[model samples]
Target: MTKVNVYVTLRESVVDPQGIAAKDALHKLGFDEVGNVRIGRLIELELSGTQAEIEERVKKMCEVLLVNKVIEDYSFEIGEVAGK
Candidate 1:
């Protein structure tokens, strides 16, 4: 079995409205030192498969449905849990 960790976020060139909002809120809360905030999604998936299989599956998921490559960026890692 393997555990996969996936992350999706807007590319640096893309504008993030929610991030802007958070930055503003931080300023209002007296955290003027906060410059920018970026938003992203993290997904954890457990699968009964080898590490290579998990990588392939997550790669396909990222390319086909989880993310839009043109405007966003995504990365994932696969790992085994201890002795399992």
Candidate 2:
């Protein structure tokens, strides 16, 4: 089995309202050290395939559904899970 960790985040040009709200709330709570904040998503998938096959499938998955190409950018890491 292959473990895929997908990280999806808004593009730099896009505004993140959730992140802004969280920052504001943190400041109000006295955690004022918080700077510019951005919100994102992490998708963990366990797939059965060889590394190359998994990579191809994951790329397709991201392009087809997992990520929004217009405003979001994504990256993924492929790894092995021991004793699976």
Candidate 3:
């Protein structure tokens, strides 16, 4: 089995309301050092395939369903499962 870790984040130009709210809450909690806390999504996919095939498929999945290419960016890491 293969383990693919996908990260989806808002573009730099996009406004992240959730992140801003979280930062504000943190500041209220005395975490004044927190700054620009951008929120993102981490999606883990388990599949059976060759590295190249899995990479291609995961990219397609991101483009088609997992990420919003218009206002977001995505990246992924592919690795083999130890005991799968």
Candidate 1 stretches greater than 4 Å from native: 82-84
lDDT of 3 by residue, 1-84 (tens): 889999999999999999999999999999998888999999998988899999999999998999999999999999767466
| Model 2 C-alpha lDDT per residue in residues 1-84, reported as the tens digit of each score | 678999999999999999999999999999989999999999999988888898999999999999999999999999776456
Alpha-carbon lDDT, every model:
0.85, 0.93, 0.93
Per-candidate TM-score against the hidden true structure = 0.86, 0.94, 0.94
User: Candidate 2's C-alpha lDDT?
Assistant: 0.93
> How many clashing residue pairs appear in each of the predictions shown?
0, 0, 0
Which has the greatest lDDT? 2
Alpha carbon deviation, residue 84, candidate 2 (Å): 4.3
Model 2: what TM-score?
Answer: 0.94
Show the lowest summed lDDT stretch of 10 residues, model 2: 75-84
Lowest lDDT sum, 10 consecutive residues, model 3, at 75-84
Clashing residue pairs in candidate 1 are: none
Give me the candidate number with maximum TM-score: 3
TM-score of 1: 0.86
